[model samples]
Target chain A: MLLEMLQSLPQVLIDGLALGAVYAVVALGYTMVYGILQLINFAHGEIFMTGAFIGTTFFILLMGMGWVSSVPQIFVLILVLIVTACLTGLLGMGIERVAYRPLRNAPRLIPLITAIGISFILQDVIRFIAELSSGNYIVTGPSLFTDQMTISFSSLSSIFNDASFKTSFLIVLVTAFILMISLDYFINRTKWGTAMRAVALDRETASLMSINVNKTISITFFIGSALGGATGVLFAVQYGTIDPFIGFILGMKAFIAAVLGGIGNIRGAMLGGILLGLLEMFASANLTLLTGGIFGAEYKDVFAFSILILVLIFKPEGLLGKPTAEKV
Target chain B: MPILEVNNIETYYGGIQALKGISVYVNKGEIVTLIGSNGAGKSTTLKSISGLAKVKTGSILFKGKETMNKPVHETCLLGMAHVPEGRKIFSTLTVKENLLMGAFSVNNKQLIEERMEIVFGHFPILKKRLEQKGGTMSGGEQQMLAIGRALMMEPELLMLDEPSMGLAPIIVEQIFDIIKKLNQNGITILLVEQNAYQALNIAHRGYVIRNGEIVLSGKGSELIENIEIRDAYLA
Candidate 1:
């Protein structure tokens, strides 16, 4: 069974990379918020869900207007993604100002509880909006990419199934990589990025340097949530369906990825996200064979969390996080 | 006109009063040092002028403008720079990045470059360690980087809190030499220091603070020779 799994590893790896790309994008939101404010931002998942819905709504509206057929497919997709990300970024900034800003000096637990509360509020609000519009909880995204969009790998088709490589997956992976690279550059090179890092390291000192701490934090939220929103658009396109409930599981898995990669570290989040996605795909694909039919794809989620628990116990600072010395 | 004027400012941290109606002022092109023991409200006084500490009842006039109600960054934009206590340099950032952040309010690239050149001239070691992280550097280097960062704003008034803290005597002497040169080059300075002798040596005027109040004020030479200052602070 192990040998058979090794033979199919390439296919599993490809699947994992596509899924991992999405998680890395989403995990960025969690990691950034935690880095500056030390808040979990549990509402981030709902923000992702809202982005998916926003993208779906725009696509459906465009299709209804018959613009999708006339416009280039790539243009429409990019338009949808940009609009969704901007709207979600605004929503994230609004949430920070209204909910988290007031509680900045409150105890850690207070803001955490507020974050969880915000999460539920966002889910219910999205659900209400959906029910009001279509009288249904689940929304089906428009099929943006048809068979013509598929990029076939004819040479590799003999080794792995044709289904393993798809144009949508390639688009998602490439877009995610571009976003990550840009984010890395923005955080490391830009003045605002330096301000963000300074604020995260020492708020008082950052202020003394004349950095507008509040503005820096608001921009951080904007960028982080925008990344999550972009990921949501890609997820909706890849899956062709989204609901308010979808954020719960996906968000939790992304959170696990963030924690696994060392929650406050940016590069760690990317590495952790891809590793978690690969682990999930491999476990679902090979576990039943290895265990002689005792475990199957149904236990894949459980396997992911079990690994999270094991990692937390053994390396709580995470795979890439340095153990920080607590200041007196 | 005095560059910075603080009048009877009372600042509190929660319920505890840190500054009790303390007043100090700095004139243009002068080094004014505030010497005090630990917890003597020296830092609090500096914070109040920079808008970091709330003034319950007082007025801080900077260049003839009421600055008590301004935000920290606003005061900074008005040509006031504070190199805070503990040398609060951004440890995770590179030395160059830390200096760049000091120029946060300035948008002119040429002016920033000019300021960078001036900073490098003052502390040539910082120019060599531009890519090094602030935290990994030696204490004296970090202190220089902190001062270099404050200079990036090209401020008219520079407020330093304990710039000589935790440095070797030779390094502290080097830092004091830079402070004197900066004042000579026409930047007003408000210095807070535990090393009263070194501070007063370079300062044109001085204030001796104790337990949130100013106990003595005079010329630097006079304060240096005062029996009270010699026994309480110098000794």
Candidate 2:
């Protein structure tokens, strides 16, 4: 069993990296919101689900109009991703203004509960919309690529079969990485990003410095939710199907990834997300063999959540977060 | 016209009143000090003028225009800068970044660069630690950075709350010296300080506030020598 696991390590690593990339992108939404507001933004999962539905709906609409058949697949995918991101970004800002802004000075529990309530509201809204439009709970995304739409590793053809890798996975991984890098640069390099950091550090001071606190918070929601939207589009393409309820489990996992990486730390979210993905993949792949058939892929979520519980119990600050001393 | 005028301004925090019918003014290029003990509303007066605190019954006129209803950032953009009670500099931001944030309302890159040079001249230590984190510095350095940051805005009126709050006596003296220099440079100043003697010594005029009401107002030297002020505050 150990030798078999060793032989499959390379394949596991590739699969894990791709899956990890998706989680990292989604986890950023949670981390960025928490960093600024110290609120969990439980509704973020719904935003991701909304993005997927929106992307899927747009693709279906394009197909219905015969545009998908004529347009290049990449162009169609790019269009859907951009539209989905912008819509979700606006949705996120609306959530902030309507639900969270009024309760800014309320006790911490009030906003947190509001976030959870917003999450449910978003989920139900999407479900209602989906049912109204499709007459079904599940939404199937259009397949933009043919079976032949794959990149063959010609140089490694002799060692590993050319048919093994999917170009779609490569595209998702590269796109996620590029988005994450640009986000890092924006947060560190731009004036608006500096204003964001200032507001996160101290809102009143940031305002006193002539930085518009409301605008900064709004922009933060926009960027964070936009990333979630982009990730949602990628998830729909990779899975070929989405539902209003899909965000629940995936969002929980992304939340877990944020906590694992350090909830308020950006780089930590990325690290935690990739690590959680790799763990899920490896455990699911090797569980039966390692546990001598006692456990199987069906236990993947159980394994993943157990890590969250363990991490929370032992090192709640997470792998990269420092223990911050709260000023009285 | 006075650079700033506060007329019968009343402010509240929740149901409790913090500033009750307080009125004050600072003429152009004058150093006006508001001296009070803890919770006497010295900070509240500055906050009211800067639009950080809501005024229920008073009008704040800046450059002879009513500004009581303006938001904090709008007031800041209109050339009023408030260095808050605590050195509330963004701790994670580098020194240069904090100063740059001070100039957020100023869009001209050339003006920002010129102001940066002027700020460096005021607090030369800041130039040496431009890349250092704001929070890691000593109290005196942070105070300098705070003052330096406020100066970056090129405000017609600069309001400071407790600039010497936690600094050593020597650093406090240096900060007061810089405040005087800033006043001499043709900037109007509204200084609130618990260190009454030092505040009045540098002020052209001063108001003695106690329990949200002004008890005395006079030229700086006269108030410094007033028996009531000397007994109640200077001591």
Candidate topping TM-score: 1
Give Cα distance to truth, residue A302, candidate 2, Å: 2.8
Q: Which residue pairs come into collision in candidate 1?
A: none
Model 1 C-alpha lDDT per residue in residues A1-328, reported as the tens digit of each score:
5557766677678789889888888999999999999999999998999999998998889888865679887898899989999999999999999999999999999999999999999999999999999999799977866453422343565444333565777778889999999998999988898899999999888998888999999999999999998899999998898889888889998988999999988988998898898889888888888778998888877887798889989999998987886321
> For each candidate, what TM-score against the reference?
0.96, 0.95
Cα shift from native, residue A200, model 2 (Å): 0.9
Which portions of model 1 show Cα errors greater than 4 Å? A146-163, A326-328, B230-235
Residue lDDT tens for model 1, B116-145 = 999999999998999988888888898899
Report how far off residue A270 is in candidate 1 (Å). Answer: 1.1
Residue A162 C-alpha lDDT in model 2: 35
- Looking at model 1 chain A, report the run of 10 residues with the lowest lDDT sum: A146-155
Taking the candidates one at a time, how many backbone clashes does each contain?
A: 0, 0
